[model samples]
Target: MHQEPDFLHNLHQELRDGRRWLDRSIVLAYAAAAGLCVVAFTLMADAGFELFQRIYRWQGGWAVLLWLPAITVAAVWATRRWAPGAAGSGIPQVMVTLDPAVSEHQRSRFVSLWLSFSKMALASAGFAAGLSIGREGPSVQVAAGVMHSARRWLGPHSGISSHALLVAGGAAGIAAAFNAPLAGVVFAIEELSRKLESRSSGLIIAAIVLAGLMGVSAFGNLSYFGRIRVPSLTWNALLPGLCVALASGVLGGLFAKVMAASLTSPAERMNRWRARFPLRFAAGGALVIAVIGLVTGGATFGAGSEAVKHMLAGEADVPSFYVTLKFVATWLSAWVGVPGGIFAPSLSIGAGVGHNVATLTGSDSIAPALIAMGMAAFLAAVTQAPLTAFIIVMEMVDGHAMVLSLMASAMLASLISRMLARPLYETLAHHMASALPGPASTQDPPEPAHAPGVPQQK
Candidate 1:
């Protein structure tokens, strides 16, 4: 073969190198765009809740009771009519899209810009409706959708898999939403991917950093739940910590069990009824949630993030049955076919459990510590992703001093949760995967069978 000149070879090599850089730049752009989307999402969610609060303050309980059902009816109707895939905690949808068996055409319906936008808007409506739902889970889908949108721009030759995009976007969502970069990374590894590929490590970190920077710029560098001054763990504190952990484990497990049962009810008739009369069903569920809110003096409404903050600050005076009532409220909200998440509500419920445990044990001095532990343990139990749960709680509370205890509590609670319910998100993902059209659905590897019904578009 004739030898090419060195200059020609160098020129070709430079072109190749330039293309690689361009591809990387595109990915960075996607990451940055995802972060911007999350920031907008956070603002929208907060604004919705603020509007609801204003309405409540203006007209009192009657207005709230009416607002919830009416908005929920609208939200549920809009969800079913337009973006059915946007319903519920969107984590499961993202999880399903990651399945290699799911074709790109199929995955588009699950993770696309339109679906993500609808999810954000509808979830904000849920917040305005005083639904006991969170934005964190929806954030994952939104960011994933934004990140995944680059597929057409960067062809298959770009060496970036859809898997990497989805994972990065989802992780970025967590980082931005909670302002916890490390927790975001751990969540990607522990919950989203189960195992992070070495090739994706740089991408994941870059996404998290970009998203987290956006969060910091918009919200300030503060803990998600505000920091607490926890005393060093001592033998005297062990008993209280353990009690909180046990309580969180059982309660969280119960919540998981009930959730699984509600979603995967063996009663096909009920599912049919719900499908046929989605508006009526949503209205009914909304009515129950409104009643729960009234009974709890509105403590159980709107994801309970504020309530958890109040408890941590020792400024809350929750009802004795707050935990159970909030649990019912969150579950009903999810059942109402609205677009929202359980993450914040779950943390609130955990805080209530911790409060009750501290009160029962007369450990007021260490209540904050117990509350932190409960948040971690219960989340761990519910998700069965102990590392992610613990890291989230740790970051939210700035609880470095309580690291060991939080880890222990999360591990124990996750173990106990397994005894009562299978991994909640994975099981739900399995249900969703099984519902996809085509033979690939049948080829999904075995996963936990005990899952609830997924939000399917009619």
Candidate 2:
């Protein structure tokens, strides 16, 4: 009898351990799935942009005039009708889910699989229409949704909570989207979770690694903007860095402020008009973008990545007005309530600003360094997340030599941005939380499947 009881206990213990490993394995599997999704989305976005370029080359201005408005209407309408949570850059949506005030029900809706599907499909549609948007931001939500879906498969004894899944998914998204694993980890700490829990550290890093591995497998070992060769920066480059930081800070701050105002403040006339007739408003915004594109010879169109790459390669000289028009185009693209992101567009605008600063300073010799700084500074100012911005820019161009400069520019620009507006993602997350149907709750939300685990703080 004693031997039988011991044998049963041993078997039970082994089975329990097996179950735990299996549950953890599910998390890893889902993370890899999220990475695959991001890689696919990247391919889809590039294909969509190629299609738009073909149309633009054939009919030029005429094609854009009719094409942009029609696609804008379709994207906006589809988002509103099907997946309302898939609107905007999607970063705010993921951020809102992290708020403690939001109920599990609300959080689930925000990051559902349907929303992820719609986000990718509709965002790709916007790309085809030549919208000035990026995929990195939306990738966060998409990956989060994919990861969150794993909650259904996890057992009650599973150690990883739903919150951890969401955070891991988001980090994985960034890692895969940009092929920047460290930047993704920084983004999770600085922007997504606001604090990296000891318990979640391994999971987050693993997710980023898996996601990055997926990207590397598909694209090979290439940086997002390719390796930009930068020489040693002497004291002379500092002045240009400062100037680029100032311009990016002001412009990025204003962009963030206006975007938040449009979302949270219904009193704004444009918001009111948009609320009444969203289609008309989107069409109007499309018209404005079309006119800007026509005047800029299509430089202001798309996400502005190709233009930035060409500039970095010394193959193209963008018009001096590129920054102003691209900024307006990006702003309008966001305001029109499409499923898109400002991340790439913000980088593009920053590149333009840096180029102009280089031109003005006659620092043609160090233009590449300044361009990289501008990209980091403007992104930092817009998002108000200096570390993430710096690391992202550093990784994108393999700017290991310019680490100190990139960090300083990002920090200064973020500080300057604070004077003009609140943190862009935080402000938008608050608005999104407030717009949810139920009153804010003070009590902690029950975990998915009612299993207890550490919850992320807002």
Candidate 3:
């Protein structure tokens, strides 16, 4: 016994030591990747804002409308030519990487990463073109893709471990984008990855903290919406707040249903007109332009952040007509096959709706609170992720005090929306994937044997 020294035991001990070292290395890699994503997104967002401002100065109000058509055409062309998988929100594509329903050919980590990058670029371009979209979701996809690539290159043997890193990167992306580490971690757990293991939790935390620190160091610790102070809470206000929350939830549900229905029907129609995508997009762009020209005097075409600011600053009266116009414009722009996101536009709509309610109630002070609540509520309703929605609004507005109301609103909205329709991402993914050829007919290219991570369901 002494001579043999338990050979199997010695081997097991060595393997355990190796695994510990690998885990440490993976954590370090996650931290670095998270930092990089924070810097990239911050710089990109700042530069994108400046570019849009320049375009506005040069082309006048007409620039906003022109952006819709131009970006739609470009995004459509790029998707069809370079990476068809990147056509929509990169979330669906990421899901495919994990599920591999198509075939081995489509399951390459390289394809996932490349398609994600292309989509990120296109989405950024679309935003710079003055389309009403947000970079957060795209950023999440891009970060995950980058981490996937890194794992493939540096830790090829760590397939299962790499999934942890992918989640870490995604969390870091959200943290970097919003400068809210806790919210980012929660989002990764609740929305993107949909699962949390003990080991992965530590990795996610490290990534989020590092990414948030990087964002703060680079951008001077600025919140996405600056600071929003809530008024004193009162027992009397609770009832009104509840009523507002209920209404917002119902409306949010209805909005999500309408958008999903519109998107699915038109996308189906597009199958027949796939050959003329460019022209169709161009025509759609022209329509966007005309809508802006007529309704907003050319003001409501872009991300509507400026409009939100105006409403918040008490500089403008948010009329129903404007809300309706923005709603229609964003709906059409998204429906017409443009590579954009719904977050910003949804916030804009929420703000407008909140302002309208405030005017009706003759209370300016309550508007901001209502706006925050409505933003979360409506988003929760549409996305069907109450926790994510609540955290997103909290981070977006820097409203910690309103967390309770935000939670209430979000839950109500999610419940109502569920009753009205399916979750936004799920519906979109299902409709899009259903149209594609079956896995048997379309096999993915050969690739490394990456572990299929758990798929995130909405």
TM-score of 3: 0.82
RMSD of each: 5.3, 6.0, 6.4
Candidate numbers, best TM-score first, in rank order = 1, 2, 3
Cα lDDT tens digits for candidate 1, 175-272: 88889989889888777776666876786689778987888998899998888979666698888888888889888888888777777664767667
- 219: Cα error in model 1, Å: 0.7
RMSD of candidate 3 to the true fold? 6.4
lDDT of 1: 0.85
User: Which residue pairs clash within candidate 2?
Assistant: none
Which parts of model 2 are misplaced by more than 4 Å? 1-16, 441-458
Which number leads on lDDT? 2
lDDT of 3 by residue, 133-247 (tens): 6666666666666666656444444434555666776777777766777777887776656776675576567767787787778777766676676888667567556666676
Q: After superposition, how far is residue 197 of candidate 1 from its true place, in Å?
A: 2.7
